[model samples]
Target: MTYFNDFDINENIKKAIKEMGFEEPSPIQEKAIPEILSGRDLIGQAQTGTGKTAAFGIPLINQITTAPHVQTIILTPTRELAIQVSGELQKLSKYMKIRTLPIYGGQSIGHQIRALKQGVQIVIGTPGRIQDHLRRKTLRLDKVRAVVLDEADEMLDMGFIDDIENILKQVNTDRKTLLFSATMPPAIRKLSRRYMNSPVTVSINKSEVTAPSIDQVYFKVLERNKQESLCRILDSKDPELGIIFCRTKKGVAELTEALQARGYLADGLHGDLTQSQRDAVMKKFRDSSIEFLVATDVAARGIDVNDVSHVINYDIPQDPESYVHRIGRTGRAGKSGEALTLVTPREMKHLRSIEAEIKMAIPSHAVPSIEEVVEKQQQSWKNLITDQLNDDEDLSLFNALTEELLEQYEAKDIVRSLMKLNFSSAIGESDDGYNFGETGGAKGMIRFFINVGRNVNMSPKVLIEEISNAVGIPGKAVGRIDIFENFTFVEVPEDVAPFVYEALRYSRINGARVNLEPAKPRPKRENRPRPARPSR
Candidate 1:
């Protein structure tokens, strides 16, 4: 079971593996393949980029025959992963001439129907699309022998659990089912308990969950200034291969466009990409042509690249585990890498959670300055020039031209002009000038004056607890409390202000109507004559 050759795989599958240039099996494949080929249900706990597709795919494809019905269904969380898994399956089944179809939303249903009519042995699709096909009766699971759920946890996160349950119900309970996820959440465990029978559980250790070499870091920045800060960091780090993680597909597209407009060789990877488009983008990324890849969490899950130097979190991930996975792209193969996360003030709690889970403190760092970016660029150019000088090449013509120019102008002048031409134009506007407003700094606290005070039987402690319970703000961030006859004033962190404001805007406090607004500046107290030098 340590090798794929140990299994009773067909010749065509072996040939396909050989053609695909896969000789040794990955750890997951080495362990899970044999169990799956033995017709046992499996629950694999492993991260993406671990070759889980082949672990489940090879056995499933080997089981597929010349039957016209769909014998295997692979469900993925996103459309991009669906197409990617289907393409891998097709490649793995190439020698057997197995027919595989990818079905997902945002595509023509009629086309899917036509392809289904043509008889696909395997169908890879998303939950919503698969449910649609099931409703239309365009897909049949009666003959299905194997079902694979890739990134099952992600599917649950997207609220597709019900659809997944329905799809599993449609499949034969006696058939082999495989569920793979990075983390085993409670819901997934419950599903396996209910649907799978005596399933063999294979768990890859968390140390091996992601590349250990990937260096991870996070930065706290205002949401409005995230783009500017990201550009500054990228300019300063200047990664040869990098990826920026966003939350949505639209975010990917927009960020990719913005990066490209600024002269970076970047591209978007998301569910919207066609198979061919995805291939092109990955090709560029692999060939070192594209330096920046903007992608969502699900779309970028399966990407395995060794040369990536940095990973940027454009949006603070919803979960701490996702942050780990997103940054695992870099620092691979014993290489030192960098990861940066852009977080807003409100999201600091999430950041703290990540730190608590990882058991490591991510040191806070300031965004790079424009001058630093220019210095880094110049250093890179200097390195490039040094390499060129060291290379054995015919530079007689260039040397002669340089000598001629040196005679007309001083060498320093010529170098200065050349540097200006090569590097000055590349320096972009500095992000330091970009204002995220006063809401960014901790100094800017939200001030709200309440109409309940000592006269109305109110204390700061009660008011603090009430506001905290009502708007979800902790008491620690609630600043100074001032009590007056008719009103009380309190300060909250700026980031939490908007939410507290909206929550209390129309709500009554202590059964009395209240008003919330920016706190008025406290009037300066004047010193009266020291009590007439008094009674001392």
Candidate 2:
């Protein structure tokens, strides 16, 4: 489909697309939307950047009616993604009358239940929270016209296969099933075969996965130095329009606040923000009022801009496909763009995996030193002066002061003094004054204490292997592992700590369920009772 109007979609959908600034369908949307509209089971193999959410959202919303029972439900792997899908559906159903609600774990269940009782037509949620509603009989799925498994592979990786099976079984057998994922692993394939009815697969070729116009590179920096390195890169690139991608909502908020405190024109977007708040932030970003937009992967999916010169990954993307999506925000509409990733020493292995899967060798580069950054800024400063001189603006207001200063000091000295005034505020912005707060571990690591150890046959090797398999992260990313007689202390990357926690909270180790929590500060040795000395 060349244009959204070319397809046999609802008039309201076309109107919403126009309002949302999209005139045409992406490759994935072009293929998937028609099949979905035809009421057949669909298996869409496309990443986030290809507009897969809208691909399914358009048809799903088009078919669903404002019924008393839920007519459509979308299952996403993360809370943020669930909210993103709900927001996208809200836009697509703007001209129509429909109610969409996103239910996830952190929010109060009573609030969700109250909203559910008000008769919502569409529900989007994470698997765990959806399961809670299912157990409570709050979600009515008997009238469901369609079911969408957004990011199927991500759900499988997060150990939600059983939950998915349970939820699918509750929906009526005649409903359409749609599964969208970046890759079709064996588990996801098995799932589709068992649950779907003659599903048609839509995939974008490898060549279309990423653009060649993007100049990609990676930098190895300690976790403590990530913000500092990002600042240096920002000063060096001076992108006209830039977006910084972070993985978690907390990361987005924290990074946005940090950049703002440092005098950068930056704002953040995440699921936590209200719709009006998101609109304000995006409006600022589009009109160039904000130079850098710090956002998560899903939150930035709908961002369509042509002049974005750079995309910085403050926290490395978890997958190659997500890397493609993150960088795709830039390099739009035939303009060249640059992308940079910051990796910790332990994350280099994961970075290599992304490189191998993406089939591109992201060259390594050192973070610009303070001296190098200053030199580049000095050149830029000179260019600014040249441009000002070319503008032919009158300088009579400052002429008398310049003359007085010129009489007191050499002309070169006068210029140097101006330089000092310009650069003094920004000097050594991160040298010793930077705050890298303690995260219960060494820099870049968050130490977690699991309530299972040698008592349940746990060992360092077993712990590392089990965690790696459970969370889909490299064993190296699991930092130092120390197994005690009854408990264990393990360190993991700060960025990945949440995933580990979520994946392992209800998980079993050595055939016994385990509990995981952040390690509290160890008390002074004297605060503990002295152990009895064993007889020699």
Q: lDDT at 509 for candidate 1?
A: 62
Q: lDDT tens digits, residues 367-410, model 2?
A: 78787778888877889889988987887899889889989999
- For each candidate in turn, the TM-score is 0.64, 0.59
lDDT of 1 by residue, 1-536 (tens): 35556679998899888887777887789889989989899999877656788999999888888978888999998776887788888889888868999998888999999999999899999999999999999998998988899999988988999999999999976688899988889999999999888999997753554446656666655455567678878877778788888999999988998888877899999988786788789889989888988999867855777788888889888887787777767765457788888766556657778878766767777667767777878777889789988999988878878888988999889988887766653565544322223321227676676665666666778778766755455887788776766777777776566546655555566677676665555435733122122235
Candidates' C-alpha lDDT: 0.78, 0.81
Clashing residue pairs in candidate 2 are none
The TM-score between candidate 1 and the true structure equals 0.64
The alpha-carbon RMSD values of the candidates against the true structure, listed in the order shown, are 8.8, 12.9
For every model in order, what is the number of clashing pairs? 0, 0
